[model samples]
Target: MRLSAEQISHIRAVIHECDPEARIYLFGSRVDDHKKGGDIDLLIFSKHLTERDKRRIRLRLYDRLGPQRIDIIIARDLSRPFVRLAYAEGVEL
Candidate 1:
């Protein structure tokens, strides 16, 4: 995975602080060590959050992770195709 153990812990802490019930997954290129130059792909499943809250969560992540590119997917529904795919292949940190 692209993220370090410390990074994952930091992310989990931030996520829980924002939404205590949230379930998080680290997916996409970051899941494969052999792959290179892929940004961090995250899928967060929580009760609906306002757009502003979503933005804040993302900004918080970026702030901690530095300038590195990362993508956050706020998922209110796990039945979505992409989320299901991520669940199948992604790791839960």
Candidate 2:
């Protein structure tokens, strides 16, 4: 994982604040140590988060992390191929 301890803790704190049952996973380039620069890809499994909640969480993350690309996928409908791939490859945060 390319994320620092502070980054991980902050992220977990932010998410858990909203939904304590939420499960967070780190995927994409950041998961690969050999890989170079890429966006922060996250797949969150949460029963409590609606679309609005997801958006709010994202906005909060951006505010904390600053201007950068962060792709967040809510695991609501797992029928999507990418969602499956992300979950399979992801490392839980």
Candidate 3:
């Protein structure tokens, strides 16, 4: 599905508020014009990933987006190697 500019902005806003130091990358079909059938894919990297933070993010996004399907992968800064590999392999938004 094509995401509206507003939706992207909302997502970015939530990410910024939830984890100011986090790096968020959009990927999968949500960012690919040639592909079909997929939800918004987000890879989030931060120095902190506490349970409370995760719950807050999920709750905030669920409130904004409703039941919309979203694939979110949260990782730590130490996982840069794997995240970089995924990016290099064509996971771009």
Candidate 4:
């Protein structure tokens, strides 16, 4: 799925509002123009994300997007080992 510039901007804005220090990235088929995909994939990195925070973020995104399919992978900032593996193995959006 290709994200429009406006869609990207809206996503970034919502992410920043949720966690200013968070690092937001896009990956998977959305990044690969040649591939066919069904949903938008996002990797969110933030040391401050608790379970409550995750729920809130998810709800907020759903409210803003309204039925648009989204796959959010949340990780901590210090989880570099896992992040690096994903970076190398995952498709970049």
- TM-scores, in order shown? 0.88, 0.91, 0.72, 0.75
Predicted structure 4, TM vs. truth: 0.75
Candidates sorted on lDDT, descending: 2, 1, 4, 3
Best by lDDT: 2
lDDT of each residue in 6-25, candidate 4, tens digit only: 77777787777878888877
Tell how far residue 49 is off in model 3, in angstroms: 2.8
lDDT of 2 at 79: 82
- Using lDDT as the measure, name the better of candidate 2 and candidate 3: 2
Stretches of candidate 3 above 4 Å error? 78-82, 89-93
* Model 4, C-alpha of 23: deviation from truth (Å): 0.7
Q: Model 2, range 2-80, lDDT digits (tens) per residue?
A: 9999889888988888899999999999999989889999899987788888788888889888887888888865788
Per-residue error at 34 for model 2, in Å? 1.4
lDDT of 3 by residue, 5-89 (tens): 7777777778879777777777667766778767777777777766677667767777887776776777775446766654554
Off by over 4 Å in 4: 78-82, 89-93
Q: Give candidate 1 misplaced runs (Cα > 4 Å).
A: none
Candidate 4 worst ten-residue window by lDDT: 84-93
Report clash pairs, candidate 3.
none
Ranking by TM-score: 2, 1, 4, 3
